[model samples]
Target: MKCPKCGKWSLMKFYICKNCGYKIDIKFEELVKRLTSENDDIFVSGMRDACSYTHSNKFYGVYAMEEAIKRKAKSENIDFYEPGFTYRSGIEYAEARSELLSLARKKGFLADVHLTQELISIWLAMYTHLDFNDLAEEIIEISKGLDEIHNFQLLYNQMHDTAVLNNNDVQRE
Candidate 1:
């Protein structure tokens, strides 16, 4: 089995992520049982738990959850939207991330200082993660250093330069 938290392969018997110690003991049988449950709370809880396990692109639980969602909606005679994460190839993921960052930059450019700060906060949250610890720390420090509204322009300039560089890099690739 793959550990949903760390994307590492682990023996099924271990029920743990070898790299991050995240619990991977999702009981498949129990999850299926809950899907068939009549109680709304139990079924909904199962679905929510299933969504969390979707970080592992290879995990079967995501498909099971999708099927369960479809079955439930059909039986209940309603339209439905599946509520779990979708797996994307590396290139697709990169493109989506780039688009999102571009949108944020454009919006921040037109926004007031308060809105710009909010946008920056959201961008940092989405961009910074464990894999980029040093980069994340540097970004956080830069954001913090921009204490005055006047300094916001500096941040915007840096973001624009980054976007230009990212575009060049992508083109080269």
Candidate 2:
């Protein structure tokens, strides 16, 4: 296959073009389908491993999981349950997942399960909705009872950096 931009011929099976940084013989739709669905569990596990290894940046893993969920939802035609608001039609779940993941990437965390579940509790009198801050706090609290408390600062810094980088990328784009 040849690089469309530079017309470079190479025998490399799959690679970005070295000559002009053009991609050769690529199928974006197929790639997206595979990343989003095929062997999804493996992808999720990879993201989880990345998170575990880095220790400071779990948002990447979270984003990967979110993407997988979005893809599955889109493929299955599942609608996100937005409490109180009428369900929007023709909404692509993968896009929604991307949006949520982007939000988390910028904001530093995804909503914890409990907070996400409690979004319907209007009587709780919470002005703000559930979000990543709650999750970070929970992690910190849990670490206090374990041997991992020493590394909480690193994780916090990583979250902050990730948010900053995501925000910068958005502004630039």
Which candidate has the highest TM-score of all? Answer: 1
lDDT of each: 0.43, 0.36
- TM-score of predicted model 2? 0.23
Stretches of candidate 1 off by over 4 Å are 1-26, 56-58, 67-173
Query: How would you encode candidate 2's per-residue C-alpha lDDT over 1-173 as one tens digit per residue?
Result: 45544667765545776677766434432333333433436433443443452344324433333333334333323222223324433344224333433433433222232222222222112323353455345444543331121122223333333444455452211
Q: Write the per-residue lDDT of candidate 1 for residues 9-97, one digit (tens) a residue.
A: 77655576667778754676467556546565775575556544443322344444433433433332322221223444555545543
Clashing residue pairs in candidate 1, if any?
A: none
Q: Which residue runs of candidate 2 sit more than 4 Å off their true CA positions?
A: 1-50, 75-173
C-alpha lDDT of candidate 2 relative to the true structure: 0.36
What local lDDT does model 1 show for residue 68? 45
